[model samples]
Target: MEEHGTTQPGDGTTLVPGPGSAFRRTLLRRMLPAVAAAGLGITGIAGVAHGAAGGPQRTAAADFPTWGTRWVVHADADTRSPAVGMVNASAPGKDRITADYQVDTGRRVCEGSSCSSYMAHLTGPVSGFLTVVAVAIPQDRLPGIPVQGAPPPQPGVSRQEMLARAATWLTADNGAQVSYSQAKVWKDGYRQDCSGYVSMALRLPTPGTNTVGLATDRGLTRPVPLGELKGGDLLIDATGDNNRHVVIFEKWNDAAHSSYTAFEQRGGHGTDHRSLTYGLPGGDAEFTPYRPVAFSD
Candidate 1:
């Protein structure tokens, strides 16, 4: 049980939607709402790039034998800009590309034996021509494509190991706490938020589960009383919104239990090991304690 309560300063970060940027508008109007319904919200943007392959509908991978790639023609030819649009291999003419869509670059047009189609997102709007590439899917491999929002399989972990994992970001990258950003991921591929941090500590699948998943997913965690919170447990404010926050419980401050020590990755503070009153009487009442169901110890 670790109980020190001093904060180590970490860089603060923010995302300013670019004015008149088509990508920003498209992301806000199209991708966000879809991803939100998928239980990922805005933070899921980073994970989508890594080939979490589900879409509104599932098509048999066998139906498509070739994946399409296109070069973005824009004002800045030297600086390649990703063109964002819905890819309809079946569509004719300009009917295919419209609005903004986040493309999952991680899921290639062809994987060993399986194949999947992908969409690409432009960081900004650029007017130019497109050069399309048709890559044939290798026939030797079997079809095994992952759907979007699907988490990869992982094994259980011990409490000591979990805490140790949590401690790494405190001084990760030579004494720099992993910078916090919903739009970004740490070096390990986990989002840099409180819930993401806890997910990393618990050794969950990459990009990590969102706050709602951590609190409600029976396979990940279960409700536990504040009095019972032990090392590696969690205090999550699962509001199912952008304001949600979570912390890894280190230990209680005293027998009275007015506060406790925790590891949290917060906006403006990054990863921190400090005292928190989240579930206490006068603190934010939204926080509820939970225990990871995957704990091996």
Candidate 2:
């Protein structure tokens, strides 16, 4: 998806831990059980989207209640609206985007609500921030809240749509913002790790399901065979406790079908398109490929 310059903690030189690192080796050593427990792993494998709520109609600039105002915050702009379905709320884009101005901002003088408390109610990382004054208030009077744009989040997103979003973000603004654990997006924004990237691409609502949770997620089935792999499948490794990675399978390119292409978010970079070739640097025996339960061959 992208190739930028940024590294995670401890390891500064390389984007990811080399094959010899304890993180990698320990995971590989225990890979046998995880793989066997998964019931699918001989040599190679691979594999690889949410909804919002419904409130009231847009109050229109004239009718917004004087006591409180409305707000919307999302990583994307295209799906935002005054009411749940009032503005750009439409089809094709499906990433949950809803906000309450009175809550996030200290506006409307809400009784008890802090930024941290409001953040818990949010869908994904804080991507967009918007505030609207109930009365005809001047823009300058209020803080300069920019109107960022992103495609609307659909109830369900297709594999093609998912890949398309990944491709755009890889090189665009939100791409590569969050690669490290302690770091935020770029510097201050919503940052997506490997699983976060997939969650965003798939328009998933939950954000905590990492590599391991994703592999065994109820929404998805066990790993599929290499021959039946599809464009939207996933290649993941969940052996280590905090060591895991997930790549969105793009396609394969080899005479024996041993190597393939994928999209992922690495520690050094944000989002990237990669070729998982066997016997090479990224190639390893600990990986597993899986697919969505609804995915049909």
Candidate 3:
């Protein structure tokens, strides 16, 4: 499958909208019904993570509000393309429902940026309840593609050269490129938008890790307290909304009582660390925390 941006009309990329925007009200109404159907029961109540042998055991949802630690409203054109999994409304061989809109169950796996399509597809219009299962792909299984041949080295390369070289080696030269119709060769490609970037940067499995599945599959299924965040850990926005984003924690700022220096790829940049303040956008940023498998070492 090829990755491209969303093409839905009138979906401008903005972090937040003016009060009383139709989009804002529509989003709220859609989200509430889905949240309610997920058995959230009441707003502001914590959610329970299911245990290995048993069903759900009650647990509190983190107090963090909104989607993503930081996000920009991407023009529909820049948004990742849609893919229908077994759960999506457009899932092959499935009947479409007119009134039922899909809601994200927050069960997600990282398959590069393809995860975005999965999330979006499942959350699109639907009337009945839909359950989503998170699944992660191991790195060794990533598909290979052609990449650009080496370009001549420049004289007196700087830090930028070093970082770019790293990206090239991990993505283009190392069998990491994904197929793109527009170019002879494309690196930093995957079914999802950011997955390929993150996977190559961290040397994690392609198609990336599923935040929910990674937690359960690796035996770190317990809900971590916000205070326990450590450098190198992953902070994931698993709301399944467009506001989803992820970051790698670099350190904690005791003076500010908030973590500092985390890495993320936003607005067409490679992964790099910035202050947590910069990480959090003014609007449309939802986030959840995860520990990257690479960092566990």
Candidate 4:
């Protein structure tokens, strides 16, 4: 057992404070072993654990299982800031920042032939200490060269099924809200952006393709007239990196086809199901409606 004022978690050693500050240091030296033997854990003390001499020292975070299992981390001591570390749920322009990540225990992040750290996965956009928001793991880099490209899209995904998937992000039980982020991928392994959200709804592979891929991939979607748009169609603007965006067309808002309701993952807003006028007359001309290739219709 190593002797120290305070220890890290699971070290089998800890600091026991006394009534007087002077006595604290003096009493700890004498009582540490007894406390360790008795397995006494006193709150408010940082515990450190180490193996036998020439053995390994494991951090509490390191001890946590990586892949599959979900973990929550805080930004500060008070547990107030949930958006920290490799996963950030903070909305665009929000000052909240973090690197605390949800990781796949055994899987490491890889870039081409070069692999470095563990990959991050997140559960929600933003969260509290107890709130299990979207799962976020550390993604050392955005557009990371994933060890494997996204698996092929699931076949025969229905429009209703796609809408149900999109609804998950809107429901309170599903994190009540998902904060917008381009750099982070959601627990489901899709990018946390408009195109990513649509990919998730479309049952595309993890770490989904970008807006351009969704819009231009003839095998993914085909251009359709605005009047022909249906429940699971898309209104995408695939012009350029900075100006590109997409939304999942849910249904027409009215019989007139003047406006429509859609699901969109946009900046500032994580995931939203709302009415839109992107392709309607006098609306944003950049948007063009399209039908996913997977749909039977």
TM-score of each: 0.52, 0.47, 0.33, 0.51
lDDT of 3 by residue, 1-297 (tens): 222122323443111111233344344433432232232222222112222222222233211112211121121212232323222223321332121111222233221232221111122232222221111111111122111121211221232332342345324434543322111112222223333344334533222333344344454223345556665455666564664455555567665544466555543444344667423435234555555443333
lDDT of 2 by residue, 1-297 (tens): 012112333433212111123343333333322232122111111211111123212211111111111233323222122222111222211223333221232222111120111211222223343222211121111111111121224312467876785676566654333344312222111235677677556655322246677788767547787677778777777775446788888887775677888887888776788778522235665677787654544
Name the 10 consecutive residues with the lowest summed lDDT in model 2: 42-51
TM-score: model 4 vs. ground truth = 0.51
**lDDT (Cα) of model 4:** 0.51
Each model's total of backbone clashes: 6, 24, 25, 37
Stronger candidate by lDDT (1 vs 4): 1
TM-score of 1: 0.52
**Cα lDDT for residue 185, candidate 4:** 50
lDDT of each: 0.52, 0.41, 0.32, 0.51
Overall local distance difference test of candidate 1: 0.52
Q: What digit string (tens of lDDT, one per residue) describes model 4 on residues 1-297? A: 111123224532222111223343234333333232122111111122312233223322211111111223334222223434322212311222121223222323221222222332322332322111111123232122222122334733799899889888775324676667664555454667787788778876544667888888898999988788989899998885347899988889888988999988889767888889987898888898899999988
- By lDDT, rank the candidates, best first: 1, 4, 2, 3
The 10-residue segment with the lowest total lDDT in model 3: 133-142
Better of 1 and 3 by TM-score: 1
lDDT of 1 by residue, 1-297 (tens): 011111122411111111223343333333332232233233323233223435422322211112222223322211133333222223222222211232233322322222223332222222321111111212111112222454553523677888899999999956888778775445464667777788788866555778888888888889987888999888889984447888899889899999899888989979899999997899888889998887743
